[model samples]
Target: MISNAAKAQPRGASRPKGLETAARVRKAALKRFAASGYAAVSMREIAADVGVRPGALYNHFPTKQDILKDLMLSHMADLLQAWDSADFPEKMDPLERFVRFHIRYHLEKTDEVFISYMELRNLEPDNFDLVEAERRRYEAILTGILQDGAARGRYAVTEPKVATRAIIAMLTGIPNWYREGGRLAKHDIEDIYLELARKAVAPGATPPLTGDRMT
Candidate 1:
């Protein structure tokens, strides 16, 4: 007979062996892959970091490339899920909403962002296709937003797909040099970038002041 205390001890108290091992493997792999390029990391090193035998690692991930594929796929899938779950203001402009969301999301997952872009060449052809498909799906979200805004005459974008590519490239580059205690706070950076993105497509944006002219 089981007691209430036993049932209420919480799930982590008795986590399944398989799940625990897999999670440790993922953690070790992520750290290794990020610190060193994927090509430089070996299954034995990951297994050693997890305090498991190399052979045991193969039981979970048949090959190191499999682990790399999983990591890449998971990163993109998580980004898509986060975007899907984001709460946007009911009255917020779509472009503004997207700008804030992209900045905040990418900033929070800097390591994942770094690895995803830097390690693409390491992925095999089929794996690359799978990851790229998810990436394009995510990109489509912004493209759709720009297209709708243009159709409503809120934005001056002539090519929604081109605008999407440019905007995403600009936003995703933030994690490269941004630091927590930098001169600008994350919100400040977001505001600046948001305005930049808005003006990039804004209909009838004010012309820049000339050398001798002031607005």
Candidate 2:
């Protein structure tokens, strides 16, 4: 279980009103979306949560769907920015850097991470396309890392893209079960996951991945 002492409260109504109304709406929506599925949440409820009348909510987000789109888009953008700024060691192997940086960055953002995965089906078609494109861009970063590692004989990835997806799935699943002070610390968990990831693509783990199996 994550330690209560280490956990930061999810942004909520108690926050100072210094934030712009739109920013407050985004923060409130994130809390509500994570607590209730996107389909079950309504614009009125979000407006109430943010201490605004429903009409005022429209000034910032014309529709509830617009709010959902903004939440998902900003989440992805923040994730990318966090990864870029992570204090990865300059001498670290690309794979090791990726593993550590990913786990550390996401552990601090459980709510955003949860909604990013659980609420995608609620996105409208155009919004879905926009979010998916950003997601693919982030995934491409990992794919490129795997390809580079393979070319250097550091990893035996048979399909860089497939390996990228697999590794991400494994890492992203962390927030589902992790707590701040579980039987293992975050660093210990990161190390264990890193070893599992490293071996999965190690030179002799499995035969070359097939094109059809590139899922």
Candidate 3:
């Protein structure tokens, strides 16, 4: 779990203030998305949830589609920015740092990730293409980690791309399945997935990026 102290001040991360109300709309969109999925949500319904008359919503976003597009596009931009700014210590072992990055991401932004993936089909072709490009960029980072670790002999993987997708799918699936006030704590899920991802990418033995010298 991200500490409360870190939430207020992301060192390199900031967003526009006028976006706060629009953010409320996005929050409703996310909940509606989780419950009924995207197609069922309408601009009027979203505006109502935001406590404004339906037409007032157009002042912020011209169309239902526009709001959806902004939700997705902004989400991708925020994610990439956060990822690009994190101070994961380079001195840490490769495999541990790799898993820790994903854990931190999942803990901090799981809802946004879940909403982004689930509502992707709602995007128009051009908009979808834009988000997909950003998604591919993030995927490249993860796959690069896998390939680098494999090359360094710190891990074993037959298919880095496929393995990377599996790990992401497993982690992304958590928001959809996790109960809010239920049995397991959030960190339990985090620890389980970190180890699960390690095993999936390199099973049955210890990963030794720290111990073995890198060639």
Instruction: Write one digit per residue (lDDT tens) for candidate 1, span 29-95.
Output: 9889889989999999998999999999987899998888888889888888988899988899888
- Tell me which residue pairs clash in candidate 2: 2-179, 2-180, 2-181, 3-181
TM-score (all chains, Cα) for each model: 0.86, 0.86, 0.74
For model 2, the run of ten residues with the poorest summed lDDT: 10-19
lDDT (10s digit) by residue, model 2, range 124-214? 9999999999999899998998888888888888788888999998999999999876799998998999999999889887865466754
Candidate 3 residue-wise lDDT, 1-215, digit = tens:
88877886664254454367777887887777666777887877888888888887776788777877777888778877877887878787655665566666766666677668878887899988988998888888888988988888767887888987887777777766776678888777767777787776664464555766777
Question: How much is 35 displaced in model 2, in angstroms?
Answer: 0.5
Per-prediction CA RMSD (Å): 6.7, 10.5, 11.7
TM value for model 2: 0.86
Model 1: lDDT to the true structure:
0.89
- Rank candidates, TM-score, best first: 2, 1, 3
For lDDT, candidate 2 versus 3, the one ahead is 2
